[model samples]
Target chain A: MTTTNRQVRLAARPAGEPRDTDWQHVEEPVGEPADGEFLVQVMYLSIDPAMRGWMNAGRSYIRPVEIGEVMRAGAVGRVTASRHPGFAVGDHVSGTFGVQEFCLSDGRGVTKVDPAAAPLPTYLGTLGMSGLTAYFGLIDIGRPEPGQTVVVSGAAGAVGSIVGQIAKILGCRVVGIAGGERKCRMVVEEFGFDAAIDYQSEDVRKALREHAPDGVDVYFDNVGGDILDAVLLRLARGARVVICGAVSQYNSTRPQGPANYMSLLVNRASMTGMVVFDYADRYAEGVARLAEWRAEGRLTSLEDVVPGGVAAFPETLMRLFRGANHGKLVLEVAGGKGTGTVIGEGGSR
Target chain B: MTTTNRQVRLAARPAGEPRDTDWQHVEEPVGEPADGEFLVQVMYLSIDPAMRGWMNAGRSYIRPVEIGEVMRAGAVGRVTASRHPGFAVGDHVSGTFGVQEFCLSDGRGVTKVDPAAAPLPTYLGTLGMSGLTAYFGLIDIGRPEPGQTVVVSGAAGAVGSIVGQIAKILGCRVVGIAGGERKCRMVVEEFGFDAAIDYQSEDVRKALREHAPDGVDVYFDNVGGDILDAVLLRLARGARVVICGAVSQYNSTRPQGPANYMSLLVNRASMTGMVVFDYADRYAEGVARLAEWRAEGRLTSLEDVVPGGVAAFPETLMRLFRGANHGKLVLEVAGGKGTGTVIGEGGSR
Candidate 1:
C-alpha cells in the first residue's frame, strides 16, 4: 500500500492549450478522516472538457482552480475511512474529489452511489454532472418539441452524447456534429443520432443543411467558436440554443464569437446559457429519471475508462481536445495495470 | 408642387460603408392610383440606421432592398389622391412608403396618424416603429425589475433614447452609451438617462463598472460590436440582453462578433434578438400605453427632423453613422426649405 498520495495541481495559468509544465505532480502523506468527516479513495476521475476552463485565471461559471491547488474535477470513489455516523468504510460515493488518489471529505456534497448496480466510471460520467447537465440544458433550455430538429456539437463527448440521446427519446430529429469519421459514426450508430456530420472532413454548413433540411430547432452547444457560428445560420424559426459549454474556446486566449448571431433576429430565436449546478435542487429528480431510463434499456451509459490514476490526468485531459475518446472519457487509479486503453470498449455502452 | 418625382434606387450592393455610388438618383413622372389604391405625397421620411441593413444582399429580419429597386423606408405623409374608400385626400397616414416623393399604396398596411396629437415626424419615429421597438424590447424581453440597473447603447438615437426613458419610468437605474461628448450629453440631459458613457472618449468597461457597480440587469443593445462585448463582461446574474439592432455592424463587411460572449454562461444570462415586426399583434397595445405615458408627462418623444427631403436621405442617413443626429433622424420630402434643421429645436419632444 502506498503511504503517500500523488496529486496533480495547477502549477500555472495556461496561455492556450495546457502543456505538461502547467501541472505539478506532488506527493503527500495520505490524509485521515477528522471528526464528522470521511476519507474517499478516488477510483475514477472524470476527464471533462470543462476542466480546461477551470485552469484559466478568470471568472467563469465556477471559480477557477488556484495555482498549487489540486486540479478541480468530478470523481467517483469509495469511502475508505470515516468518523461520520452516516457513512461507513467500503461505501461507494461520488463528489468533487479533484485530481488525487485519496480525498478527505465531510460528505457535504458527496452522493452515495451503488457500484454494484452501475459501474464506478458510469457514476463519474453519465450518472453524474455530465448527465445532469444534458438533462437540464436540453429539457429546460433547449425545449425541443417532437418532430423538431436538434443539433448537438461535440457529439462524442460526455454531455453532448447524452443530449443527443435524450433529444432522440423525446422524438426530435437528431443530427450530431463531431470531429473525424470514427466519431461521426459512433455518434450515429452508437448514440442513435439520426445523422452525423464529420466536421473535420465535411463543410459543416453544407452538412447541416443536408441533415436538417428544415433547419435546427434546438442546438445543444458543447463546442463553441466556428461550430456555433455555423449552427447560427441554420436555426429554425424560434430556435432555442443552449450554451452549455464552450470546450473549443476553453484553451483559446482569443475566443471567437458567433458573427452570424443576426440569424437569431431573423428567426426570432434565443441563445440562453445554463449552468447545471443551478438545478442542484432538481438533481435527485434528474438522476431518478436518467437511472429509470437506464434500467428500462432506453438509455445507455457510455464511459471510456482509462487507467493511469491522477498522474495521467494531464495527458488524459488532452484526449478531449484531440477528440480521441469514443464516449465519456474517465481516468481511474492504476492498479498494477498500464494498458492506457478503454475498458469494455465496444457496443452501445 | 413638382409634377416629377425624384427617386433614389439601390445602384449597387454596399461592401462596407455605403457610398454615393450605391444609390442612383432617377426622375420619374408621378403616377395616379387605381380604384383600390391611394397616392401619398411623402412629407416626413424616416431615416433609420436599419436602412443600412436593408441595403445588404443577405438574409435578415426583412427582405434586402434589391439592386435597382426603390430604397425602403418608413414615412408619414398625407394622401394626395385616394381612389379607395378607406383613405381620403388630406388624411395623415404612416406606412412603408419607401424613399421617394410620392408612393402608391393599397392601404393594406397603412395606419392613420393624427398630426394634431403629435408632430408628423414623431409618427415616423418616436410614436412609430422605433417607439414600438423600444417598448416591446424593454418590457417584454428585458423585463427589468424596479431598482435594477438597465443599460442602453446608441442612447441618442431613435430606439435607444426611448429605451432609456422607459427604463427610468419603470423605476430602473438607466445608463446610456453613445459616441462623442455631445451625444452623451444629449442622452443624459435631453433623454433623462441617469448617466451616459461616451464610447469614443471613455473606456466602456470601466465606465460600466463605475456606473453599474452592481452589474447591469438589462442591456438594450442598439449597437452590437465592441460595446456589446464590453456590456457582456459586466452582466449581473440572470441578466437579459435585448438584441434590438446592430447599427454599428450594419455597414461592416465583417461584423465584429462579441468575443466575450462566454460571460453569458458565467452570469447564467440570455441574449435574445427581437424584431418589432414580430409584435404586430401587440403594436396597438404598445402604442396606446406609450400615448398614455406621453399625455401624463411621464414619456417624451424625440426627433431630429433633418430637412433634405428624400434627396438628403443619403447624407442624413450618414448622420446616424457619424453620431450627428441627436434624436430620431427623419428626412422629409425636399420642400426646398434650405437651412435644414430640427423642427422643435429645444427641450423634450
Candidate 2:
C-alpha cells in the first residue's frame, strides 16, 4: 500500500480559464479508516466542465469548491482499508472523492460497483454520474418522443454523447452538434446518431434546418451561447430545452443568454434546468438500465483516460474547456488495468 | 345605420418604433352580413402590446396583419345584423373585429359578452384576453405557492396588474415592477400587491433584493429585457419564470436576451413561455373565476378608455409603447356610459 497520498488543491479562483498557478500539489501521509469510515485508493478521477463552475466563488446547484480545499471531484476507486459495514477491502466503489490518490469516506453518497461486470473506469463514466446526468436530464426533462428530432450540443463530450445515444435508443431522430469533423463523424457513425452538425465549420442554424427539417423537439443543451440561440430558432411547437450545463459560458466574463428566447413564446415551449443529484434516489434504476444496455451491446461507454496520474489533474481538466478531450475525460490516478483499454485516440470502445 | 365604415389599415411594416405612415385611415361602404354571418357595430377596441408584434412581417403565435389589410384588433361590439343561429341582434359580443366601426364575422372565435353584468370595456380588459393571460400564465406556468415570492414586471399594465393581484390572492408575497411612481403606487395601494419597485426611479436588482429578500419564486415577466435580467439574478432555487410578453423588446430592432440566464441552471429553475390563445377552451372558467373575484371586491378591473372613437386608433395604440396608458388601454368607438368612468388620469379605479 502507498504510504503517501499526493493531492491537488485549489490555490485560487480563476477569472477566466484556470491557470497552472490556480492549483497546488502536496503529499500527505495516507490515514487509516475511522470507526465507520473506509479508506479508498482512487483509481480514476472524473474531469468535467462542471469542475470550472465548482472553482467559482458563488452558488450553483452544488456548493463551490473553496480555495485551499482538496479540489472536489467524482472518482472510482478500490477500497484499501474498510471499517464501514457497507464496504469491503478490494471492492470497487464510486463517490465524491477529491483529486487525490487516497480518499477516506463514511460510505455516504458512495455506491459499490462490480469490476467483473464492467471495466473499473466505466464505473466513473457511463455507469456513474455522467450516465445518470444524461439519463435523467434527457428522459425526465427532454422527454424525447419516438420519431421526434432530438438535438444535443457538446454531442461528443461525456454527458452529451450518452444523452444522444439514449435519445436514439428511445427511437428519436438524433442530431449531434460538436466542434470538429472527427467528432461529427464519430457521433454519426459510431454513436448511431442520425446526423451530426459540425459547428466548427458549418453554420449551426443552416445545418440544423437541413438535418431537422421538422424542427427540434427535444434540445439537450450542454453548451449555452450562440449554439443555444441556433437551436432556439429551430424549435418545434411545445419543444423542451433541457439545461444540462453551459460549458461555453462557464469561462465567459459575462454569459450571454440565448437571444432567440422569444422563439419559446412563438413555439409555446419551455426551457428547464436539471441537476443529476436531484434524482439521486433513483440512481440504481438508471445504473441497472444502462448496465443492461451495455451488456446487450446496444450502448457503448467511451472513456478518455489520461495517464500522468493525479499530478496532471489541473492540465487534464483544462482539456475539457479546450474541447481537446473526447468521450469521458478521466485522470488515471492509480495507473491500473483501466488505463490499458485505449481503443483509439477518440476513446471509442 | 351608418352607410360608411371608418377603418384603420396597415400601409407598411415599421422598421423600429412605428411611424405615422405605417397606418392609413379609410372609409368603406358597410357591407351587410351574408348567410351564417353577422354585422357587428364595434363599440370598443382593445389595444395591446402584442399589436406591435402583429404588425411585423413574420411568424409569431399568430399570423401578421397583411399590408393594406384592416388592422387586427380585439373589440367589444353589438350584433346589429345577425344571420347566425348562435348570436341574436342587439347582443353584445367580443371577437377579433378589425379596427373599424363595422365588422362582418362568421362568429368563429367570437363570444357573447354581458354588458349589464359588468361594463362594456371590461370585456376587452379584465374579462378578456389580458385576464385569461394573467390567469393561465400565473397558475399553470408560474405555479406560485403560498408564502412564495411572486414578482411581476409591467405591474401597472393590463396583464401584469392582474397577475400580481392573482399571485397575492394565492397567498404569495407579491412584488410589482413598473415604470413610474404613480404606477408603482397603484399596484401596491389599489391592486393589493405586497410591495412595488419603480423600475424607472430605482435599480430593479437592488429593489428586488430588498423586497423579495427570500428570492423570487414565480416571476411573471411582461416587459422583458433589462428587467428580465434583473429578476434572473434574484431567482430562488426552483423558480418558475413565466414569459407572458416582452413589451420592452417588441419594438427593438434586435432583442437583447436576458444575460444572466445561466441563473436558471445555477438555481435549477425554469423559464417557460405561454400564448393565451392556447387556453381558449378554458377562457370561460377564467372569466367566471375573475368575475366572482370582482364581485367579492377581491379584484379590481381598471380600464384606460381613450375617447375620440375609431379615428384616434393609431395614437391610442401608441400609448402602450410609451408606457403612457394605465391599466388596460381601450379605444372607446361608440359614445357610451363606459368611457364616462375615468376614475383618474392614471386610470386607477
Which candidate tops DockQ? 2
For model 1 chain B, where is the 10-residue window of minimal lDDT?
A: B338-347
Q: How much lDDT does each candidate structure score?
A: 0.87, 0.89
Ten-residue stretch with the least lDDT total in model 2 chain A: A340-349
Writing each residue's lDDT as its tens digit, candidate 2 over A7-59 gives: 99999999999999999998999878888988888888999899999999876
Kindly list the per-residue Cα lDDT of model 1 for residues A34-59, writing each as its tens digit: 89988777788888888888888777
The positional error of residue B71 in candidate 1, measured at the CA in angstroms, is: 0.9
Error of 1 at B148 (Å): 0.6
**Model 2 local distance difference test score:** 0.89
Tens-place lDDT per residue, model 2, B171-274, is: 99999999988998999899999999998999999999999998999999999999999999999999999998999988899889988888888888999999
* DockQ scores of all models, one per candidate: 0.67, 0.70
How is the predicted docking of candidate 1 categorized under the CAPRI scheme? medium
